[model samples]
Target: ARVMVAMEAELQQHPAQGVLVVGDVNSTLAAAVSAKKLHLPLIHVEAGLRSGDRNMPEEINRLATDAITDLFFVTEPSGQEALLREGHPASRIHFVGNVMIDNLFHQIGRLRADPAAGGRGAALRAGLGDRPYGVVTLHRPSNVDHPEQLAGLVGTLRTLASDLPLVFPVHPRTRSNLSRFGIDLGPNIHTTTPLSYMEFLCLWKDAEIILTDSGGLQEESSAVGVRCVTLRDSTERPVTITDGTNILAGTNPARILDVARTALAQPASGKRPLLWDGRAAERILDVIVDSPLFQPV
Candidate 1:
């Protein structure tokens, strides 16, 4: 609501410029409505991705935002197909590839140069100290809101605790849910606050495996050649599964345990590069500049 009001104010103040809205669904929708009202072109990044579950607010956001966007910058060909299925004009959709790929490439050189990156990897190994460990991150409301779901995930983690350390960077919302439900963190499960992007990337790089409910992390884990077990039933990015880098475990304890065990049993192998060549932003800019419809504000 606050975002809507702010966008309305911006539209009222200056209504002639093109506006691009980035981020989650709510912000995208708010920007779209404002852009339409102001007769401005609206661009949506990370467009046309869906988890196929109406229970998730993000699904609604993706659909609603795409409805009003003038330019849809998608990460994958699948996203373009999804937009076409929804009746989005073919000319409006552009597969600019994943911006996160651009981000990762931009940072790789720096990460390699930084002593902290190596030190952090060493520190993670020292902390685990010869014990196998898997990184876990949970933030979805579906899992955290329901006691049964939360308990199921925790139970799976507990079972694996003897063989592997589960490093969980608990989202504050999930933490609150944990307290509300009285879900106890087992001794082998190390819970901590969210890490910075660099810190988290380093951890992901070093982990034997990753179990997550985050779409971005799922992609990142695959990009770094780590095996990922997604806690969600479905994913917007299905390429990870096709590439054999990730498996959807849902919230089923048995499924989660089985998948995690399988992932641990296998030798670590890098996944095929599925994102982009790290020039997505440049490509997007080139396309925009070349397009006849493009007019810089």
Candidate 2:
């Protein structure tokens, strides 16, 4: 693959002591494979996550990348347990918490400091000032690629919109589906093109609730203490549900509506998962320095 070749060339020319890859994307797997083939130590961040759905491409990437990873940096206890069960050495697996949450906190601090930052966020706020709103995002192939399933979700969103204003940052795939399937989001649902990270963070941070099929949003919402309803049936990040304010409603229309309604009615309340205190990157650095892979020969 292109990523593998590029990684190989980069390593051959610059010869790093260790190669680090993050998350379960295709590039992560490619880089992991390249590192192993070149006899370099492969460090994987956000490793050992499993959604148990082999059908998901990301699940496959996680499994394959962890199989050859030398050091595993995990976000949650479940990740550590999953790696242990898969026969990875305990010493190599470090529970360094979620770096994404750290970035979330950083961005939020920036927004708070300025209050006038993020153009789109300010515009959105001006439009919906002093009113409670909800956020919706759907992009998973399991939900959007299939017409029948997508229609069901749209219908349910329409119903929810009648009661609550829903701001949907529609993914390109979802937008195409809307046009192709002739699905109307109804007047109550406001659709916008995808937003910048700060714009999105500003929009969702104070929302009453978020409806999403995204893996990262689930964790971000939980970190911000905002109620979130996951549109997917299974999530790799179970800590969000157990310790944070995330509810799994799957794709079923009735369940999603019921859960979203209940979540909206309740005040957001949840403890941050252990070590999600914006120090995960620091912990990762400490581990790397202490690790044998980085020790002087």
Candidate 3:
């Protein structure tokens, strides 16, 4: 593959004892394959995750990475069980919490320290003016791939927006989907380009409710005590749904609307899950230091 060749050349010049790949994307799979071919230790972060749906590219990426990685850094206990069930050696698995949450803590501080830099959040406030509002973010193709689905989903959100101002910070793919599907964001729905992380967190934290198809947002919402309605039927991050404040509504427009309504009526009474205390990066470093692969040549 093109990626493997590129990685091989890079490694040849600057040899590494180990290579670590984060998140389940094409790059992670490519790095894991290259590391295995080179006989170098591979560390996989946010590993041992599955949605039980092999049809999803991410599910396949996670499976392949776990199959070959020398060690795994996981976010939750379910990851442990998933790896164990797949016959992975228990000793190689390490639960170091959600590293993403560490970034969340850092960005929250940055947003608080400099409210002027609240990029998208500041602009949102200028127009919406702190009134009770909701947030909607959609990107996954399962929810918006087809014209019918995209139209239905947007129509539902438009209906919800009539009651409360809904800010949709659109992803590039979803923006294309809107045009391809010939759908319009109605008067009540406000759409903007993608927001910076700090701006997004600012918008999300104070939201009355959030309707999204994002796995990370589920965790982020739970950490900030925000109610979330996941537009997906299932999520790899089940901890957010079990201990945190996430509810899966599938892709059905009616069901999504219903879930959003329920979320708005209820309080964000979700508690932060275990090990989401903003020390994940520290724990990750400690694990890396202890690994024999990290020993000096």
Candidate 4:
């Protein structure tokens, strides 16, 4: 509510031709509401994604943001289909590719140019070296909010860590829960505080596989063709599963292990989804410039 009020005040002071909001975060929904109320054109980027689980707050945000969106810039074909199914006109929806992937590619290019650019990346390599390892990141409320559920997932990581090093960049919530639940990550699992984007990219890009409950990680890992085992039951970004290296293992320990083993055995395919070619921002600009909202009345 605070964000909405502040956004409303800012827009009133100096209005934009259109208000753009990205992703399913709470701030996105707040800004979207403020734009609609002010009668400004609402543009939604990374729009039309649905995990079909109202239980997730992000799903509600996505639904609400798209409901009032005048222009929809989608990342995948699934987004196009989803919006059409929701009765949004086809002309209003434009498939512009994933801007997150654009940034991922950009950062990877920077890393390649200067390997020692980020001291954290160098520090990570000095410790872990070239040995094949796995990355673990868990923070979703579904995974970390409960003791039993968190224990089961951590135990799975513990078993995997026994064979090879698993770099666990623990989320603050997950770390707190670990202390609260009396769960041990085991000695084999290398636990660290959360990492910066470049530090994390350097760490996970070279890993043999990644175990995560993060939606962005699913897509990022897939972009590099690194096998990713998503901890959640469902994902809003289904393109990663169909075209990238992501496997949905949910919270089931047995299934996670099975998928992890399988993923480890297979080589990174390096396959990327269509239009993830680091030019999504350009396409978004093209759409915005051509749209009616941008035209002089």
- Show how many residue pairs clash in every candidate, following the order shown: 0, 0, 0, 0
lDDT of 4 by residue, 174-251 (tens): 999999999999998988888888888888888888999898998888888889999999999999999999988988
> Which segments of candidate 2 are over 4 A away from where they belong?
none
**Residue lDDT tens for model 2, 58-120:** 999999999999999999999999999999999999999999998999988999898777668
Best by lDDT: 2
Q: What would you estimate as the lDDT of candidate 2? A: 0.92
The best-first sequence of candidates by lDDT reads: 2, 4, 3, 1
TM-score attained by model 3:
0.96
Cα-lDDT of candidate 3: 0.88
Regions of candidate 4 where Cα sits further than 4 Å from its true position: none
| Cα lDDT of model 1 by residue, 72-118, tens digit | 88887788999999998998889876788678766666678884764
Clash pairs for candidate 3: none
Candidate 1, residue 22: the lDDT equals: 64
Q: Show pairs that collide, candidate 4.
A: none
**Per-model lDDT:** 0.80, 0.92, 0.88, 0.90
**lDDT (10s digit) by residue, model 3, range 1-297:** 788889988988899988989999888899889888989999998998888888888989999999998888999999999999989888889998998998898888988899877887777966888598989999998877888988999989999999999999999999988888789999988888999887888787888888998878998998888889998878899999889998988989998888888778867777899999999989989988888778887
Q: By TM-score, rank the candidates, best first.
A: 2, 4, 3, 1
Q: Which scores higher on TM-score, 2 or 3?
A: 2
Q: Residue 135, candidate 1: how far off, in angstroms?
A: 0.5
